[model samples]
Target: MTKDWLTTGETAKMLGVSRQHVVDLCTRGELTFSQPGTHRRIRSSEVQRLATSEFTREQEKSLWLHRALLGPLMLDPARVLQIATENIARWKPLQRGDGMATRYLEQWDEVIESGVDAVADVFTSKDERSSELRQNTPFAGVLDDDERRQVLQSFREHRQREHAAV
Candidate 1:
């Protein structure tokens, strides 16, 4: 018996069984355990195994959605849409019948939802520097050569003055 042996209570709770049942499992060789003297202990991982439930449909759907849209939409949105549409068309109707198909549909839905929001979020979240400069800066395309030269000359003089001071 090792000191790390889980007590009967921990083992029972993990296996969703009574303390006696855990003892029985240990006795019957259905579950592996450790004992330190007369005391029993179950590993935390063993307990987690019994407590954890399989993923539900909604959870699977949400995960699929998040993963599908986790990349930039602009580079290949059409290809994305095409793949999504094809997969959805093939699987959406039979979603209840197959876990694999359900996953595909969920992923497509996630991609569309996330892609739209992501695009909007990125477009609206312009940095302060870009926003301020965009508003203040004149279009250089419209500037005559002389005007551009004057602006450049003024910038050079400003840089020289700052350097001299430094």
Candidate 2:
């Protein structure tokens, strides 16, 4: 039997996002929560339904872009990690915690710190936050300008093919 309520962490795992992302959802009024005391308790039904949530067009694009980084990341995890942390450090002091970028970067930083698997999950997961996380990814310089152009062309062609089929 399933319980009616689940903690943010549980919901985050179920949603394949950071626990903080679940908290952020609650904070943004996107997910209602019951705070019995210290932590937020979300409705299991609400979270379950969100699993079927549609990935928007922008989210789809971001997913594909992140996919471009995945191969290099997997081939040389240590170097990619170094690059990501360096990128994060460069962006950190400037954030001042005023915008969504700051918060998402923090989440991505935590994932990067957790090691390759965690970071890989963010890039490859078919979950909602993966797309959102990519928007604020600290994976700059993972690919060079030429690589970026190639990826952009491939993505454009893929989309064009999709549109043609539809």
Candidate that would win on TM-score: 2
Clashes of 2: 0
Q: After superposition, how far is residue 71 of candidate 1 from its true place, in Å?
A: 57
lDDT by residue (tens digit), candidate 1, 1-166: 3444567876665554456556655676645666767766777665565447332222232233323333523456656455645655664686565553355345445544576554323223343322222222212233347754665566557557765896
> Estimated TM-score per prediction?
0.26, 0.65
Q: Where is model 1 more than 4 Å wrong at Cα? A: 1-5, 50-166
TM-score (C-alpha, index-matched) for candidate 1: 0.26
Give lDDT tens digits, candidate 2, residues 52-162: 756544556667878888899889999988998888888988876776667887888889889888888888787656777886789889999999888888888988998
Candidate 1 accuracy as lDDT? 0.47
